[model samples]
Target: MSNVSSRVSLSDWGLEPAVDYIERVQRSDGLVPWYPDGPADPWDHVESAMGLSVAGRDEAARRAYDWIADVQHDDGGLWATYGETDGDEGAHAGDEPRKETHRSAYVAVGVWHHYQCTGDRAFLEALWPTVRDALAFACARQAPTGEVHWAVGADGAVYEDALIAGCASIYKSLAAGAAIADVLGYGDARDRWLETRADLGEAIRSRPDRFDRTWESKSRYAMDWFYPVLCGVLTGEPARQRLEAGFDRYLEAGLGCRCVADEPWVTVAESCELVISLAAVGEAERAREIYEWLFQWTDDEGVFWTGYQFEDEEFWPGDRPTWTGGAAVLAADALSGLSPAGELFTERLYD
Candidate 1:
């Protein structure tokens, strides 16, 4: 992180090609497949959509949000995988893809981002009901322990499990929901959501045992290590401390960030996100260092590879995810100050 100033400028690393990579694979109906023939997950689709918005492709971005509104289930959660041909997980082959709490809640984050970019009150109004219902669905499953369950079936049966990464995401989604509620004139609702977010952050910090009951602690996963900071739940000195805690475990020197603390694989999207997490707490020097390192992951077509295996010294899984390009564009905007919503990822969780 010492040579934070060692990057080519954002103007040289301009985001249009990366943004277009996502738009090119998006269907007319606004589904952004992970790849040309891949399934669209709600969260990744939203991410690609945000990148579109950042690239000044407003119409495509709005269409992306519209697709979410059009397909929202009565129960409010988004189908984890929709109209898919393939998935990273073999589980989505079912007729009805499973629902997940964090994926369902993420519409609020995308909705708020759209509003921030356009200042379109009418657009916010159009999306308000979707945001409100989605957050309610996730909140309804919150345990007395202050952790939201990891997922729920379409039948409404809860998984009753939790994850540090998922809950951290939901915490930020609630902040976005609260922002929407404030704009839509829901004082009590906004205030209540803020209160819940504070409680969730406490659980994440104090109760590591509350999460990932079915598997080993996900602290090994880079997302869980950085999400609280990315979400603004762990800001200022605490955020700085958290980044320091994970730096040696994950950072790969002149390479990129590790996908897992113990693994030799580094991923583009996680590295991009960590840049924002670093910037959120005034760690701009470190943020730029990582972004500069991540530039090495970009391919000739301007799309970033999904991940690289340092042990084998190659791009593993050997595919480019549209969302990875989206993440790169987003991180570039954060560093370049090129868009209104550039700071979206780094913004504070509560007013």
Candidate 2:
């Protein structure tokens, strides 16, 4: 399949301001919060770090990873959320919370992406141990049915239910983990992760009964509908078909993608993810069209808003998140090939 390339460059989007926003919100200890005085989550923090890599803020990106490495628990997990920074320093880890598998596993994706952007083998080697432990932490949660349990509570109670969207993300993280292991010459680790990933893909494709067993169906969410494709579990014609089936239900015409099927709201993050997913299955024109729709939603500082509530015809939530802008930057990179890791979302890690 041909890689997608945008007609416009990253310069055309004028995302320097968005990069500026991420830097401005980054704490002294390297945690990237949702916004100033907002909480930080590991997954979104990693996403923002990827944006820093794409925007030539390599040092900032490295600092972000270092912080992630520092905070990982001995069991190789991290709390789902961290309190906001206290005066430029990171928050204390006194607040114990549940750890989500996908959130803990995402470091592999960020570490691999940073390597792709920089080709810095020394850096990759330095972070290899952290990636190894993180994937180990996540894969240990996989059940015999091949679905991973979503989280474990602070009191050691496991949340046995699985989420399609979260598992699909873990599928991709496993692929990235395997790739990193291969590069570092850990053949045993690489093979193990590959085996786990294949089983997870099977669960995603053929084992619908395994997910959301204890809760209501999550079919209304756009992520659950398209994430398998975004994460490379679905490809070629099958991937394209899955996206087409949900187009009417999730896409908001020229605006963006709706976060949920029944909501009249459009989110920049989901829309940007959709762009990458569309491009993954060779829908270049369609991806570019959706990409154009997001340009009008940026603030005066170029930071994209959280989402727009179309019923009210206004940008709701009144918050601009660093991760949302990060998603936009990632979407542009996927289309424009502006960075070495531009195809990170478009290509499967292995055949």
Candidate 3:
């Protein structure tokens, strides 16, 4: 057990209210939209569910995971975005449908995180097929160079361009998927996921040319800078160096992390995820400090505002996303060791 929890009181940090906000945003069918009225995306949906699991709201978390099972397409993927209702002029309505491989595969991480928090082997077993199919769906789209294609279009054509942050996330998902397979005694599945993950990781760490091939470079985004570390694709001293190398470019002192290198806007979710990444590389003290800087943006109701534009000196977009709150909860857990999976980002779970 780590004494990291001694450094900060999770309750004092507003963990309860953060969890409450996530639960409140959750719809009856367990959909966790970006906000009360915003559309739901698969990756953020899973991130919020992970927060529910960390807060000991296991049943609520289960419902969120169940939402994935309910909405998953037969191809083992969900559309890139989905509105709360089908006919409204909401965020995702009337948009061309595409399935992001990273989003589709993220269920593995959520399911494994849920199992770590609860130690429910039966639950893990129940979700195993979903995990298996989702990983397969992702792997099926991988190019020979090992970067998974970012998406499949509505016409079922593969989007050839890959994203650095997205591929980093897929690496983590494949790790979780492999862990699940190992626990269930599926040796062959475990081996396959491990093999795929290794190849994907090599592409991420060594072959920058593979990503951003079709679009303008996304290197300006903070996620592209740190997600490789956050998702455990980069670890040890190299992970620490990767974060340090880009620290000044992304961090805004006493505010939060910037969404992009050129922007003065600092997003709560990005800061929280950065906190976890810092902790992942044995920088817990700095991680704690960064995590503390975030509470100033929490509203009277305890949900975090989407982001702040320091240049305009206002909360931009005026939306408090459920996934933002979820990221905060997960960051706190990573620092304070509040749940069995508290070290989820700090340490590797599978082998």
Candidate 4:
């Protein structure tokens, strides 16, 4: 799968089914479900919009952005889950629940990404106050040592845990916030957030002990293997060597990236993200190969499975995930002549 000669075009793969899936979500109200079987999540909706945008479904993407804007909380935050309210007969029945702060911060990155892709300054301006407040909310939860706490209660209290995934989200949010501030001409705020980002990056690199021991205990999880390097938080000879070594340890020929070295199925999200990471480091050839593998995994419906669960003999047993679509869109954008050249990470590479 890593072979360079195996490149394939997105159009050659017959995208009609994927287009239909995107259209179904777009025609409905703002709610987009993670799977065909479960409830909708705002984060997933944002991701779907990104995928649509990549596929040039501009109108559908715009609708998704509008839907998210409509449902944002009064406190400048968003809920983790939203019940189906699109008036579809026989939709899954359940109570909609909002997550704590950590999840809320994750949504901001998607919103910011949408704004960048569309150049919708008005939409971005409308979201600015909410985005700013959310950033402050996230920043306030940062520990003295610069690592962000895991979550904040609805009552607005900090909940700390140092989960590696949450840390990745925090890094992403801060970077997105800095971009938003720069766009909005909030010079001081942009600098402040950038400084905060630098602090967090340094903390993560210098104090690996602060992270969960489980992250270090195994080299199997694709995220633990690639996220740090992909995020621009890891660099230099040692970092690159670490990633290369891990790739040899965990990468399989035809199955894509395994969650664990011994795992059989490839996780769509992890594989797509790995492509972005590879591209970020100037390995475009390898990134292109991974991109092809990812394109192969998409079903006829454009819905990507969560993972190939060999244990259950299931391929994405649940519904198509929003993040899976999001990863695909983001990676495709990067591959389709869209470079983060003037962005934070690109600048850091030369610095």
lDDT to native, each model? 0.82, 0.89, 0.88, 0.62
TM-score, candidate number 3: 0.96
Inter-residue clash pairs, candidate 2: none
- Over the stretch 1-351, how does candidate 1's per-residue lDDT look in tens digits? 222232434356766678878889988888788889777788888889888877778888988988888888888888778654244431356554467889989989998887887888998998898888888888888888888898876566888889888898999899999999988999988988888887887888888778988876778889988998888778789889989988899988888888998888999999999998888888787888888888677788667889899889898889888999888877877776656777787667463
Whole-model lDDT for model 3 versus the true structure?
0.88
Give the lowest summed-lDDT range of ten residues in model 3. Answer: 84-93
Q: How many clashes (backbone atoms < 3 Å, residues ≥3 apart in a chain or on different chains) does model 4 have? A: 1
TM-score of 4: 0.80
Q: Write the per-residue lDDT of candidate 2 for residues 1-351, one digit (tens) a residue.
A: 335444555677788888889999999999999999789899999999999999879999999999989999888888788884333233335544688999989999999999999999998999998999989888989999899999887677888989999999999999999989888899999999999999999999999999989999999999998999999999989999999999989998989999999999999999999999998998988998998999888888778999999999899888999999899899889888878899898988885
Superposed model 2: Cα runs more than 4 Å off: 1-9, 84-96
lDDT accuracy of residue 251 in candidate 4: 67
Would you estimate the TM-scores of all the predictions? 0.92, 0.95, 0.96, 0.80
lDDT tens per residue, model 3, 183-215: 899999989989899899999999999999999
In the predicted model 3, the residue pairs found to clash are: none
Is 1 or 2 the stronger prediction by lDDT? Answer: 2
Clashing pairs in 1: none
lDDT of 4 by residue, 137-239 (tens): 6676677787776555446655564655556666777778778778889988888877777777777667666666433443356777776776667766655
